[model samples]
Each structure stands twice: as C-alpha cells, then as structure tokens.
Target: MGKSGQFIKRWKSLSYDGKVIFLKSAVCLLLIKTGLTLLPFLQFRRLFHRITETSTVKEVSPQQIELTVWAVDTAANLLPFELLCLPRALAAKYLLRKVPSLTLEIGIEVNPAKHFEAHAWVENNGTVIMGKWPESVSYHRLWAWK
Candidate 1:
C-alpha cells in the first residue's frame, strides 16, 4: 500500500505499552515546543526539570528506552516544523528515568564564515544515543546533564 497505510499498519502492530510510550514522547515534544514559544529560556528549563523530576520511573532497559525515543523522534521529525535537538534530548531524558547512565550533552561550534551553532544529544556508556554527527570532533562539549 501507500506510506500512510504502511505507517498505520506499523503503529497498529505495536503493543499497548509501546503505544503508551509513543504517546508520552509526543506529549513531551508538544510541551517542549510550547514552552520554548511561551516561556523564557530559564523558565522552560525549570519546567523541564520539574516534569522530569516528577515523572514515574519505569523499570526498563536503557537500550529499550533509547530505541523507543529514537522511534518517536524519527516520527516527530517528519512534521513540517523543525523539531531540533533540545526537544529530542529532553524526550530521551524523560523516558530514561530508571536508566540514569544515559546523559544529555550540549555542544557548540564556531565557524568564522557560518557563525556559531549549538547541538544537544543523548549518550549512554560513552556512546551517542541520539543526534550523532559524522564530524563530532568539530564541536566543543559545553555541558552535560545526567
């Protein structure tokens, strides 16, 4: 069939728990997007911190959570609006409550011609989980949140 039909079939194939996780990720994305639009940067950070702190910790494997986040992000990124790194990293962090080994890292790069740019990514056990770049060496790590 067509792409929409394929997507519907794939979504229908997921277990109930998987569907719940996907919905949670979607909510996280919406919250982050709205916070960025309606609140100051610090205020958005506070909101994110509060949500993450209050979220229930599920007993799931780090790899499983990472995969779920990846799937959600992939689907979300298909939208017309830019989803960016921050929302993706935040969603991954929110889903990986029990797996504290994974951390969210922000990095920056400066180019004389192109100006400055920043990126956020998730990592577990030193391996990049999301937002990996082929030229990772070009960016200087700014800070990380665990």
Candidate 2:
C-alpha cells in the first residue's frame, strides 16, 4: 500500500481542458496493441490457460465485472476498443456508488521476467473505478480505502 499510495499521491488530476485535449489526442490513437485486436476472444484463451495452470473459473470479482460493464457502457460512444478503460476512471471519480478500494496484481506470461507482474486496482467506497498508473501490472502498492 505504501508504494502505490506514493505513486498516486504524486499524480495530479488532468484539468477540464487538459482532459478534453487528452480526449482529442486519444481519438487518433490506438488504445491497446494491435495484437490485442483479438482480445475479446483471447479472454477465453486466457481463461483456459489459467484453468490449465491454476484451475480457476475465471475469477473476475463483482467489482471487476461491474467496472468492466461500466467501461463498456462508457466506451460505446467512443472508438471500438480504444477507450474501454477511460469510462472506468470517470465512473470511479463520480459514479456515486459504494465500492471498495482494491488493488490487483496479475501477471501475464509473455515476458515474465520483465513483462509478467502485478497491477494495482483501486476502488472507491466499494466499487472498482480506477487502477494504478501506466497499467504496468508489476508495481507493488499501498493500502486503499473502501
């Protein structure tokens, strides 16, 4: 919790115009890697691989599911797969829902030494609305509130 807290503490919010400028810049950008164009199907592949490796039934928490849904809703008006996560950030800021501030750490196997690691997810009150910076999924974090 300590490290993640510090990372977030150093972050400043994007101003309204800054946010708008960011949005404009994002419009012409690619959200995920081109390889991830198949990500929707890859979720199943990831599920099977995880099951084969650890035998888990796709363990997305209620908070994760809710936020994913919210992300989908918020991204609908935007690019195809480009803005799926932005809505979750906005929702976390003003969704007015009760959710826990949870930190998540998941490791992907492509480049385990450097690429494979953990991520920090943060929820507000009880709902997961945002995540740690850079989405590196490797950094350790601090205690988040619910």
Q: Pick the candidate with the highest TM-score.
A: 1
Tell me the tens digit of each residue's lDDT in model 1 across 1-146. 97668667867888787777777778777777788889998998887777667434456775577657756585566555778888788778877756756788998875556668898988877888887877634667899887
How high is each candidate's TM-score? Answer: 0.81, 0.25
Weakest 10 consecutive residues, lDDT, candidate 2? 91-100
Name the runs in model 2 displaced over 4 angstroms. 1-77, 84-87, 97-112, 115-120, 124-139, 142-146
> Residue-wise lDDT of candidate 2 within 4-31, one digit each (tens)?
4643442235345434433433332342
Model 1, residue 122: C-alpha shift (Å): 0.6
Residue 51, candidate 2: Cα error in Å is 42
**Alpha-carbon error at 68 in model 2, in Å?**
9.2
How far does residue 92 in candidate 2 sit from its true spot (Å)?
Answer: 2.6
lDDT of 1: 0.75
